[model samples]
Target: MGLFNKFFKGPEIDQAKSDANRSKMRACFDQAVENGTEYKLAAGYTEDVSRFNYGLVHGSKSKIGSLIVGWNEQNETIVVVPTTPDLDECSNPVYYRRSEIYKAYRNKYPTDAFIIYPDKKGYIAINIFEWLEDESNYIYIDQEAEAKAFTDFFMNHFKTK
Candidate 1:
């Protein structure tokens, strides 16, 4: 019975392993920032931390950016990395102000859409609209619970008036 149990047991969650992976991912992102490269974290990289792969933004397609969600000492911080081709090498990274986020919500369709200001004609809405129109624009988060949690955290942190 012991042998059968051992053989059939699922993989145990190891704290040490999870910590090591987090450290490695952080280092990689830090290095990318230092080098000023276009580095968007892959979905797999955030699987352990449960960060939503896609980030919603506002503005025209030519003047758009990506929101890079990261953990700092267990606190979630989001940084916007511009994608415009006109951006020079010297432009500093833009970090989202928690106060500026008007609203956050999740939409369920063919693929889950974790949205920020889905309606309400604000500057942020344009980006959400664009992302919604383009099927390929959003990132694929593997776990539904993780996706919901990510949206919840964002909404909780930046409460809408």
Candidate 2:
């Protein structure tokens, strides 16, 4: 079996069980909130960023910007709402070029690694693993876990690690 299969290889979740997990996710988001930040679902959150929007030298024409739903360490999940916006505020949302903030973070971090595509309806594989394992930095997976639930079904509905 593959990684995804192994992860969810257990029995398929029944509707009731799935619904319950969904509810748990919902409650998790109710508690967390981001005060001020330009968040947009992104494009090319794939393992390989060489793809469109990601592989491009610029981002204006690329698709980015997603909705954040919930994130919590206690529950071990990051919730987000998948989005397909016409623009990405993080960048030129309009032109899709690299924004000041994006550049800063990308420069500061070793690599602009991402696990989730905040803009799309799926979990983005960000540098959470690095954040957790690396001693140089303290990555708080919990910070985003609660936010996962608040996101739409696309971002929500995920298994715990």
Best by lDDT: 1
Task: Name every residue pair that clashes in candidate 1.
Answer: none
Per-candidate TM equals 0.35, 0.23
For model 1, the superposed segments whose C-alpha errors exceed 4 Å read 1-24, 32-68, 71-77, 80-94, 117-149, 159-161
Q: Best-fitting candidate, measured by TM-score?
A: 1
True lDDT of residue 124, candidate 2: 42
Each prediction's number of clashing residue pairs: 0, 40
Q: What's the lDDT for candidate 1? A: 0.37
User: Given candidate 2, what's the lDDT at residue 40?
Assistant: 23
lDDT of 1 by residue, 10-106 (tens): 6554456434533444444554355323333322211111234345843332322323333221334444332221112112444444545556544
Q: Single out the weakest 10-residue window by summed lDDT for candidate 1.
A: 126-135
The TM-score between candidate 2 and the true structure equals 0.23
